[model samples]
Target: MKIVVGSKNPAKIRAVKDVFNECKVSSKDVPSDVSNQPYSDQETRQGAINRAKACIGIGEIESFGIGLEGGVMYIGKQLYLCNWGALVTPDEKIYTASGARIPLPKSISDELQLGKELGDVIDVFTKKKDVRQNEGTIGIFTNALVTRQEMFSHVVRLLKGQWEFAYKN
Candidate 1:
């Protein structure tokens, strides 16, 4: 089986590989077709779905396409980080899942309110470069208990379950 991921980000690619074992995995840069910083669950899911569909069948390879997107949402007057993953199978079926979420500190939320991507804001706030390619905000917040790759991996696992259930029924 061949799997194509929307982004070349190592974390996302690694998550896919971990969940979809024994598959030929490759990545392509594709547009999310949404705001760089999505502020709602609907937008975040849409971005993931868009990327997954956009990369389908690229290079004339019959492949499953995966898209992973991280964003923030405002719930109960608190801002929380959210991660979403999407899978597009060769049979034209789409599945999606979400990872764990935690409220961001007020300081980071303030910066995000100014229209900054979470990665950039996290990089500046954490005083670390390229955090997205590494542990990510989840890692920083959870003290490495749960990393970006792990978060996406969790979602991918759920997506796989969904696929199994759908086909089983």
Candidate 2:
């Protein structure tokens, strides 16, 4: 099957490609239609769903759309890094899933609380440019044990598995 991923972000595209190696996959820059820094799981998941839903009729190929969104959420009082993924088929059947969450260091969480996006804060924290396009905050926090691609891939797998179970007989 052909798949059209909702974002051109390398890690997200790589997750889809890696997880769906047999399919013809392509990506487009679709709007998540949410705040640049999604503050809760609900918003993050909605961003993914919106992006996926936005990908319909974008290209000539009959394809499914997959979206991956990363953001932070406050659990109790501590903010944690979180991510979600969504997939939408041509028929508009949607599947969604969330990935792991890890507590942020107070220093980073404080920066986020200051209204800075995680991607921007991470760049300054790691002193690297475009960390989000590379390993992402998950990589730095987890010491590279869980890369951005790996995390999104887990979510994509869940979405794909759910779709398969629901649609494939």
Query: TM-score of every model?
Result: 0.97, 0.97
Query: For residues 112-164, could you state the per-residue lDDT of candidate 2 as single tens digits?
Result: 88988999999999999999998989999999999999999999999989998
- What's the CA RMSD of model 1 in angstroms? 1.0
lDDT of 2 at 86: 94
Give the clashing residue pairs of candidate 2, or none: none
Per-residue CA lDDT of model 1 for 34-133, tens digit only, reads 9999999999999999999988888646898889999999999999999998999887799998899999999999999888889999999889998998
lDDT, candidate 2, equals: 0.92
Which runs of model 2 end up more than 4 angstroms from their true locations? none
Cα misplacement distance, residue 5 of candidate 1 (Å): 0.5
Q: How many steric clashes between backbone atoms does each model show?
A: 0, 0
